[model samples]
Target: MQSPGIPRSREAAPAGWRETADAAIEGGDDPVPSMLTALLRRPATAFSMLAVAVLLGHAAAALLIAQLPRASFGVEAIEDGMIRVTGDDRRYAADAPVAFVGSDGRVRLARVMEDLVPELEPRGSSSEITAIYAERDRIAALLREPGLMLRLPDGRQLPAAVRPGRIETLSSGFWLSFGIALCSSLAGLWALVLRPREWAARMFMLSGLGLALGAITIGALEQVSLATGSRTLFWITHINYLSAYIFGFAIVALFARYPRPLIGKALLAGFAAAQGAIWVMGLLKLDVDMLGIQIFVVLLLALLAVVLAGVQGWLSRYDPALRASFLLIWISLLLSMGLFSIVSLIPQLMGSPDIVPESVSAAAFLLFYLALAVAIARYRLFDLGSWAVNVGLSALVLIAVLAVDLALVLITGGTWTVSLAFLTAAILWLPLRELVLRRAERRRDKRDLLLLRGASEVAFAPRPEQQTVLWSQLLDRQFSPLTIAPVTCDTAAIRADGRILAIPSPLGGTGLVLSYANQGRRLFNSEDRSVATALVALVAEMVDARAAYDRGARAERQRIARDLHDDVGARLMTTLHRGDLETVHADVREAMADMRLIIDGMSDQPRRLSDIVADLRHETVNRLVLARIHAHWPITAIFDDERLVDALQARVLLSVTRELVSNVIRHAGAGTVSIRCALTGNSLLLAVRDDGRGFDVDSDTILGNGLRNTRKRLEELGGSMAVQSGPGGSVIEIGLPLPSREQGMSDRSMAV
Candidate 1:
């Protein structure tokens, strides 16, 4: 059993095997690079391709229009095509209408009655000029309103039907219109694709229906301008215009109920019934040419309904997502419809002959469609409706007040004083508003103080002084200077360092355990919980001060122990072992006396070298007398810290001084010795010169006993010793780092 079983060799196993397996099992060690790679893999969308196609189509159309002949008239009608004029509450007509021949002598018609062609006259272009044609009934009816005159290529004002040359240019306008409409349609399609779900399925379907209606409207406006010959196309244009108006109203109603299924279904049913009624009227030939007023009324009702429903839903505690949807939908509905109504009505009211009513309406609707798309794709308006209302009301009030004040001053005839006063009042609104808001907030906060009284709670336990007990459990919460939480609970007795008290709370209640220390005293308070907080700060200060004190004390003790071991203790021990009673008695007494003095000085404040130089000199002289050697020591660089300089850093200086005096007595047999101390740069230099029987400087046989040990002690003091011995005498020089006493006393130290 004693013979150990052959020990298993640990080196037989492979190295780093566990580490390799760990690395293999771990995945996704580098996260940032992998995320960047995933982002780079995302694909582009279809809208990019559609944009390219629209741009190319525009470029081709522009090229085609540039090649068309300039100022080429495209419409000519005369004679039987009678022109009727209606203006200033009356209609005018020309009987026995005669066709006006052109410069090339072509006569198109002769009429029994001409409505307004007699009002036109030609200059410098001659023709037979007399012809007749019967008036077309429908053309006469539509041309009945000639409130405005037209200018021809020859700069002549004429009736609507009687033109000396071609009256319309379709080539350039058609090419331009094609480019604009194509690009607009492409953009609209892209918008339609962009997250249309939020607008209720019915809204998206209505948008589709609006697009078809818009195309028909464009065709109707084009037909009226071109004066095409087809009767069917003429009447069909009017019906399409009515459809466009009705569909526009339906789109608004559907968008108002966006994201709600039941509202959308109800709206769709209403829209269908309205459309059927309008179609029936059109079929019966009621001639409904303008439906803008009817559509406007419908939209106004829908907006009012949306606002009321939104307020009711908010009061009923609807989900946050649904509430936000309703808010943004209402905002878009109000703003877009309001802008469209105002802008579209402007052209009709101004009666601008060049501006197209349908085109302006379409542009406004385009912007609305884009806004709707954004609202559906992004749940954008957390506060959009409120923000709009607040901003709008503020602007309106400020403008009205300022306008009234300015107008009153102006009407009363003003100087700069009145103008300046109104301007200052308007400019001061922002800061005045801010001040008022802050005051109101402060008042509200004060009123609710009772409710907030128990809102903050503080936890209490032992502070950091007792590491054996955990820190105050409530201290886990951060401390704020202005607000405090006070918590109170009984804690378990302190444990050893790092030991935790797992105190459980009762039933559903929460409780805390704290770190504690007992030095025959209780450290916590029964009242204010801040006692623990103050205790923590006090303990921290004590810890730093105690650490510094212990460090200095340890260093001083080690120095004293080393001195006794190498000096007095060694000397006494040497004398006792020699079997000389007289020498042993004297040496032991000296050692005991020196030990007592050292013990007494240990509690005293440190002293400087200059203060203790006289004592050192007397002790050195007595020792030298015992050794039968003469000695002299003169301190030249006197300092205020005598004990620090002579007792601490002067250890090397004193040792060198003693060794030099002893060697002169033992080996050199010198009669006299001189020791001098001085400062050089950051160092302390000492010179020990002696007159004795000196030996060869370089001879190995001349090496003295204990010389190596003396030189080593000098070097340990961060100094070097040089010895020169010849036939005449020997000199020993020692240099040391400046003492700490010297450092503290320096004038530059005050700046630190």
Candidate 2:
């Protein structure tokens, strides 16, 4: 139906259109800057810029990490004013209140928290006021020294060494954070570059950018604090909060206006303005309470608002496609945001240990950005078909295998870890693969059956228009589109963000447009488009077959009409005017014989050429004898095993023989008539010669009805007739094409 990944606004092109549309922006194209316009025009350029920005962000995080001192000392916050040391390469006193003294003789306090910040005690609690901004800056400055002097409770000072390397010193948590940020930003950038001016796309890009910046700040801060026991920098913590607030608001804004606008832009603007104002106030310490549980509560509220906005969006839309797109975004928001919250944010607010590391959970945000890009663009724009499922499953298996290998390395440190991981994954995947394939097979079978039944109904339709009607019905039954109408589209495409599906006609005109699929419950997705495309191709073949059938039917009717007029009518007329009973009986009998031959030919029952020749010769000789004319007909036994002919071909041959003999009997006035039949090459050749006072070949033969009908019948079967009529005699050499055995059988099957 369309290409995979994020597509441009308006779904697809019709005639003259840009891939990236800017009409949706405020003041239309006027508000879009020239530089942004140029970037949009060249997606590669936009991608390069975005990639550079992401790389720079990562580089800053990496550089900062390399600068930080590595204590390699695990710190767990036990309670206020104290900490407990866990696993470390260098053992310290088990119960020691250790303080790090930097080489600069500056002392730093170590406190561990999930976000690399000393947890701000609640205002009403015994802990009271949080650490002042000056104190936080002092702790941050002390941690900046290259290495630190470890001071334990026992008064034993240990010189902890530190090192620096851009990539080598980077921690695992940092990489996870980097991945989450990179993936999130790129997904959003795809949509933004494609549809920069589109509101939905803008909000989507904002959401991704926010997640990326937040992930980088949080990951860098947490990893640095975790490695070197130190308090989280105040500014970095504020940066994380800023990114989080922006991300939350952007999601809320996105859902508010996408699919169906749930709220006005003014309301969305107010939400954004409030976050900005509150963030500035918190940064200046004017609203200390707003920076603590208040921020989490605000984020939670924002998520809930997003859910509500999605619900309203769904309720407000009647178009199934649009609703479906909204639904995907909504569900993705809930799953990705929901998982990130439950495992990270929600737990932090609840004062419970996190279910998973925040860095690992942050990656969930990637799903939302990707989902938003596709849903807003047009959900299911691409039909990767079962291949999408295959790819997902393969990736899952690979991750599982990797996880197993890592686990094996940690648990047993075995050299066969890779082999064991692959073996385990293979064991699990083989059955899973069979199960998936079998399910797919079942679904495909049903679709194939539907196609077969539909094609038959269409191809065998009594009228051309009926075929069109049946074709429409088939599509309607398959997709259950709420609205279906004719549209002028040479090629099938999904348009209006899947509100309209254009399917090209099989009969070479514009096809029907289907909308509101599943009766307003879903959009016209790629699967629907694929089904429609396949049906169109199937119908094209069926239409061609129908046309061929109609042609054959018309030709058959004309052949039957000509046969009735030429042979039977002429015999019946002669029978009516006869005076003698014997002559009249003979005329009726000959007419009945002609009718029998015509019926046999029309019935598609092939007869042996030798038997037909013998029968015709018998009839011709009997007629000649009655007319007092000598008959000398020789049957060539050499041609009995010759090729067979179908009913129509047989009919033509019979008619030719009858017309020639009738001419000799009525007007030839010959003393002797000889008929010779031979099978030459792929033709059955026949010669009827009469030694009678023959008419002029150029004049009388042209006007003779009997000869004319015989020649016409022969020509109809792709046979030929040569009349060498003179004062001596007239000989008609007729050559009708003889069919091969296989072809004759096939033609017989299709004769009707």
- What is every candidate's alpha-carbon RMSD to the true fold? 19.1, 9.3
lDDT of 1: 0.45
Can you write out model 2's per-residue Cα lDDT over 352-447, one digit (the tens) per residue?
A: 545566777776556555755676644354322232344345445655775687688669855437799999888988998899889989998998
With a 3 Å backbone cut-off (N, CA, C), the pairs that clash in candidate 2 are 321-523
**Model 1 segments more than 4 A misplaced:** 1-44, 49-101, 104-253, 263-270, 273-318, 346-369, 379-752
Candidate 2 Cα outliers beyond 4 Å, as residue runs: 1-163, 166-177, 193-200, 218-238, 253-304, 307-311, 314-325, 350-353, 377-495, 498-551, 575-585, 700-703, 741-752
- State candidate 1's TM-score: 0.37
Candidate 2 has a TM-score of 0.66
lDDT of 1 by residue, 1-752 (tens): 01122221212111233333344445664876455434322212334554577567555534532332221112322323433322322222334333423334443333323332321111111121111111223333333333323333233434444221122433333433443355444544444334322344335445544544444345334423222222433344444545444545555555455444335567657866775676555444333322333344445544654464455346523333344444454454555555444445433433322123455455544544455444443323322334444544453444445445546657766532445555666677667778988998997687345222211111112232333122332232212112112223343211111111222221113334332212111111121133333434443444455557778799678757865775567667677676767556656655664575556456553445665445556666776677566778764655433425433444445555555554565477777777776767666677777788787766666754346666776666566878897777888887766545445432222111
lDDT of 2 at 628: 83
TM-score of each: 0.37, 0.66
lDDT of each: 0.45, 0.67
Best by lDDT: 2
Please report the candidate that would top TM-score against the real structure: 2
